[model samples]
Target: MKKVLMAIVVISILITAPLIYNRAKIEWNNDTYEMIVPYEEIRELAIRGLDTDTIVKTLYDNGVRGISFEPTGIQDLVKQGLVMTLTKSDLFSMLQKEDENTRESILYSRENGLYVLLRNDLDDRWENAIVKSFGDRIDKVTDLPIFKGESIYFIKGISKEELTRGMGAVANPILTRPIGFDENLMTEFASYGFEPVFRIGNNINENNEYVLDQMKQLQDKLGGHKIIFTGNTMLGVAPHKDLKTEDAEQYALRLVNEGFVLMPIEFTKQDGLNIYAKQFNNKIVRLHSLDFFDGRGGYTDRATRAVKERNIRGLYVHVADIKKLEEETITAEQSFEVATQELEAITSQMADKHQPGIAQSYDLLQASKWMTIAGLVGVAAFIGLAALMVSEKIALLTFAGMLLVAAGYIVTGATMFLQAASLVVSIVAATWAAISGEYINSKKDMVFKFLKGAFLALIGVWFVMSLLYGNQFLVKIEEFRGVKLLFILPIVLTFLHVIRDHVKDLAMTVVRNYYLVIVAVIAAGLMILVVRSGNDAGEMVSGTELVLRQKLEDFLFVRPRTKEFLIGYPLLVLGMYIIYQGKGWEQRIGKYLLAGGAIGFLSTVNTFTHLHIPIYLSLLRTVYGFVFGALLGLVLIFLYRLAKKYWPMIQERL
Candidate 1:
């Protein structure tokens, strides 16, 4: 019975597990609504360069049919007549001319069964108190309303066709107006069959006015319509009163189910623009305004000359329009297009300023591939030859072989591409050293002990460098030269001392000082020269007017220095350490000399530039190297003792 119950429980969990695991299933609106509204015409109203996808998405989210289009190329479309203009009859003029109770009218006109949108605002009393401020351009004055008494005047003329054309315009200036207003005005607009699209408060502090106004009016409109409310800034006058924090979703939900066409506008932001079209189950149509300059100069030239090209549908002014713009007060439409072109030019320039880091890395990899291949072949040949020599000398030679393998790692900057080769070299070298050291002891065969020592040394190199440079050295070749190579040198030197068995021999004294001085001088000189040259080359190549030489210098010498120090320092330390610890007491003679060389190299880096890393990482690298070196020493001693113990078994295997 218990078994049966357990099986049942398991089956139940299996059946429900997927449902619980896959939470938050995306809800989609499969209802396909025919886009009956002429969105292309509406898109032509805004600036041409506006992304049509943006506008279309915005409209569709608000349950606005085909009337939604990005304002990208609407301005240019207006000039081109691809988007229709509003006739006087096309005006949906809402006029409230009464004194106490307002009078209102919404004059809806259509051209061949197509809707046009044009909206104009007039106060209850036309304020001529001061000259109207319409920047710069002014021509003819046809109808001017004369203010009378204390009563407010009201006339909103909307050209449906012109608005549709404006919507389709490629580029245009932003159109802004006040938000939710008093109930009386709302009623007036509603009475005329015109939905209160947007309203403004009497003052900035009118909280919940937008929501309040909608709630009051929504009684008359719901169940099958859409309403869009757009907030321009953090300070909005609507349901924002209820929502203490800024969230677009809360505001959207307030109006989506209501039977009003929703449309909102907002500025570009980093998180990304809020698009509402998908909520209403509609796909957005992006429209872009093609600039005449960009179209004629950029696209045309690239298309003709380049191996790869793309077609563009953008806003471009005609040569005739360009001439017309200079002499006369061009149409507001024309002004909108000029503004769009300037914006596009600025956007394109900003985008071109940055190149991705991934691309730069790929370029470096392309250069490193051949270098890695050569290193692998060289290391492999050396290892195969050393293994075949099999004798007492071969065991001793293992220490020297390991050092050579470690040296290669330093030279190559410990690159990811070279890692495979480096690993193979390290393993082979370590094995030889372990087996050889054991044979030399002849009494205690401690091969395992020596193998541990070798392994530790290899690990020490990697850990020490990581502490010094972090993972940056792995990815950034510059860090390898600047920081890693410094560590690699010491490892190489220690290895050399170990192979020669200098502790019991007199030959060590002479060999020690000579190699130390040479290494120190080379390291110091390389560091100083490379840094100084790097600075000079950077200045000469980067800031110069001469392009060809500058480009050549950058590709050849300048860029490589970026990686040199990062790769170099670690290799130097590894090389020096391997040499120092490998031969025991006799190798101590060279320690001071190697130290001086490291100091010299460090001095060069310090004097030239403030490129030294943080103090903490440097200290960490130092501690790691010292600890690792000590561990390796202990292991090497153990292996020597162990090999002597197991001499007979080791000799038979050898």
Candidate 2:
């Protein structure tokens, strides 16, 4: 009963804790940052293009309840049913509450799921907020020639003739897919306080299903009321060719039906591109005149006022049979509420990955590494390990001698280590320690012990070298590269210390005979070349039919999949079998093989953990890796047994 109560309490906290504690999502945008509630707080919406009425009702009909009318309050709806939205009243009510983070409201959308914009809201009112933003920079361009018409236009630097001539030649935002206007005027328009919008297609036939479908595809990429591009004639060369009214009407209807608001161009003909948009029983806004930046016309204040009054949305436009607007579409009074709550997400992700100011563009310079003192760390650990295997006094004396030599090389320097020199010296020391420990502890022949230790020490050297930026694996750990040292070194070193048993004579004999050494040198060299070149060999060795790692990466077994299955799984399975079935030295060697195999699986798993890879793809890769790897192992095991049986019969015949 106590366990059940504890379970219930945990589940309840999971369910209701969000309501008790809520924080607004802040994201990096422009040069500054903004909370998802929108910086402007004017016509800015907590979420754009959401149709809450039908969604709540449908959910309630299906027996989901405890949701209230407002986004926050005592009877409020929860964000993802985890974090509860709180009001100012809710904050004051918690008089004991002190953390400022929990007091902020939250915004959420059902369709987009935890939507947050990393950019500023820009001016929805368009009262020169953009002009004010770039006080001096605005002076660099010529003044906008204001034209008052059915719509108003600010065309100064760019002439209207340019609009007439260039629309077709220059790419339309529609052809651009994101389908809205901002070309050449994004910073300027944004300065005027206009929402940043991508220009989708400009030559959309409202009547054409294919054209409408294209519009829909773009709309889905950016949720809700993002700006769109629409024009009557070939975008620039226009005497205002009108699309068929029926076609215009259908285009408008379909977009609304599909739950998107139209951001049609102003003065679009054939019913003026008015979209009568209603999605899931909620009205959407359409913003117009975004193309004015690209030398298209704008609207008069009266027309702009009318557009605002009708609750149109744009950052620019197509118009077709709009209205049935529920209200004036102001952020303050309308149904679109930006409140605290609905920001419930995995707190860990929110803390680590979704915090504001982390959304800046990353370049190679941003990823540039400083020289790490990792060689010293490796050196210290190597000395410590050596001390355990030998006498502490002897190990310390040797380490002191190496450090004195290193210090001599760095005379007058503040630090005692040089990056390249220290790396080489550290590798030499680690190799000596690792090999010496193995050589002394094992009763195997001197040559085999030396060979085994030498091979083992290569791993340590690679690990120390991984401190260099060039050695880090770009994506997967399963790749045969220096990155494997990060995990492999520690595990192997641990077992060598703890599970020191008889060494495998057969494996040692192979390595000592120089045959395996030659093969391994060739294989290891090829692998190094592959990694050092970033797997793009076309630069170094070019010709038709000459395979590049980039090209090889596309095939199943040849790329990541092959690395995981053929190399990783086989080692894992074979190692496990040997550990279980083989005695003495074979078991010890099996541990090493198993460790190697594990690297493959882990690297592949790490590849999938990156949020960029789709969950389905990750799943597919994992399944393929395991299944194919097991089959390969079974085949190898079968072959080994077959050979063993046949060999005994042949020996008897001989």
Point to the candidate with the largest lDDT.
2
lDDT of 1 at 201: 19
Tens-place lDDT per residue, model 2, 465-488, is 333211011111112323334234
Which window of 10 residues has the lowest lDDT sum in candidate 1?
Answer: 356-365
lDDT tens per residue, model 1, 514-544: 7889879767855654444421134323434
Which regions of candidate 2 deviate over 4 angstroms? Answer: 1-499, 502-511, 515-560, 648-654
Highest TM-score model number: 2
Candidate 1 yields a Cα-based lDDT of: 0.32
* Alpha-carbon shift of residue 426 in model 1 (angstroms): 22
lDDT of 2: 0.34
Lowest-scoring 10 consecutive residues by lDDT in candidate 2? 67-76
